[model samples]
Target: MNLDTLKQLDLDDREISIYMTLFRLGPASIRDIAGQTGVNRGTTYEILKRLAARGIVSYFPKGKRRVFRAEDPERLLQLAEEKQNALKHTIEQLKTDIIPGLHHLKPDFSSGNVSFYEGDDGIELVLKDILATVAHQPEKSYSVFSSKSLRQHLYRPFPNYTTQRIRQKISVKVIALGEGGEDAEYSERKWIRTQGQPDASYIAIYPPKVAMISLASENYPVATVIDSVEIATAQKVIFDTLWQLL
Candidate 1:
């Protein structure tokens, strides 16, 4: 049987092995399960006890030793449901209590918070932050200043970025530095004339934050996020002014 699904219930490799062995051996001793599964008797006994605690296994006295039996397979489904409910409660608690508590530990951003990141993975974090920040805003919109050279590498880490933004009903106003941007849902674009392809860089002005991404040597990506109302407002004003001129 495909027993991999048991892992979702937090069963480790040895626990699953011991449980499956019980299913096959029909109420076996620790020695019997250990011999079949190649796990030592001590580890197998420990795993059986863990599974028993989870209601996935049970045992009865058989003279000198205990004969452990696999509980009904349906117990696995019940365990999964219990975990799901626990996770939902945890998320609610995080929203109501844990997140606010954690925020108290954050450093002051009054002097302008700046963070740097490198590589595609780092860029993806910035993109996700954009979506998350904009989604909560009353206006649900942000602005961008993007260069043509940087456009191709920008979304490598997050190919579905536009799709997610559209799904969230977030809108964007973009100022294309050197042309070649696509029309996308909930987005408006304007262009700035340039003599040649400018150095590859992108600026995302989401209120209280601005993310700047650029390509380094060998087309590697580097990014910085600035978190401060003053910095973001200044950037937004410049973008708006340039946007109107364009």
Candidate 2:
């Protein structure tokens, strides 16, 4: 048997080969197991020792020769359970120690970090994080929309989103570029529109944070965000300027 399934259980190449060889050959001497698996004798011995301690294998003496046998295939499922529990426990412990520092990273723009999100779940989490940080503040949010205007855009949900925010007394000022030039989601609000200022960009201001989504389809974006107070203040100024003229 190939080691494909066993590798995910944190088994090294030699360990996997040794385990599979025992399962296939059954109750064999270490010398024979090593020969069939093409694993060196030293590595095979070490892994076999570990496997025996884990209760996945047993060694017994028949007259003078030592014979090793696999415990059961059920041991693999047990190993998977052990891994899951260990990983979850470790993650919980790490949350208090490692995650706070992780969240505290300075978003130094020059450092060049990029995250590629694949599905709706990924995009939702990104937007959710933005909303979570900005929700408590009573400041206006500025946004630039792109594919938002295309036939399959997020037009319907956006208007409701704005109205809900307005009901919550949070003002939203948007400069819709290409698609921002399209129809309104709610008729009561007049949108300040701007388009084609050399580069295609979508801008958003959420109090002390600002984000811009750009140049991609519903599946992805060439986007950026800034959480600096000074930068956000400057964006708010630029947004206010256009809010006046447009």
lDDT of each: 0.91, 0.63
- Model 2: weakest 10-residue lDDT segment is 150-159
Per-residue lDDT over 10-128 for candidate 2, one digit per residue giving the tens place of the 0 to 100 score: 77777777887888898998789989988777777888899898888899998897789999889889999999999999898777777777757846554334344323344444455
Per-prediction RMSD in angstroms? 2.1, 7.7
The number of clashing residue pairs in each candidate reads 0, 0
Quality of model 2 by C-alpha lDDT: 0.63
Give the Cα-based TM-score of candidate 1 against the true structure.
Answer: 0.91
Per-residue lDDT of model 1, residues 79-181, tens digit only: 9899999999999999989999977777767443788989999999999999999998999999999999998899999999999999999999999898799
TM-score of each: 0.91, 0.57
lDDT of 1: 0.91
Per-residue error for 92 in candidate 2, Å, reads 1.8
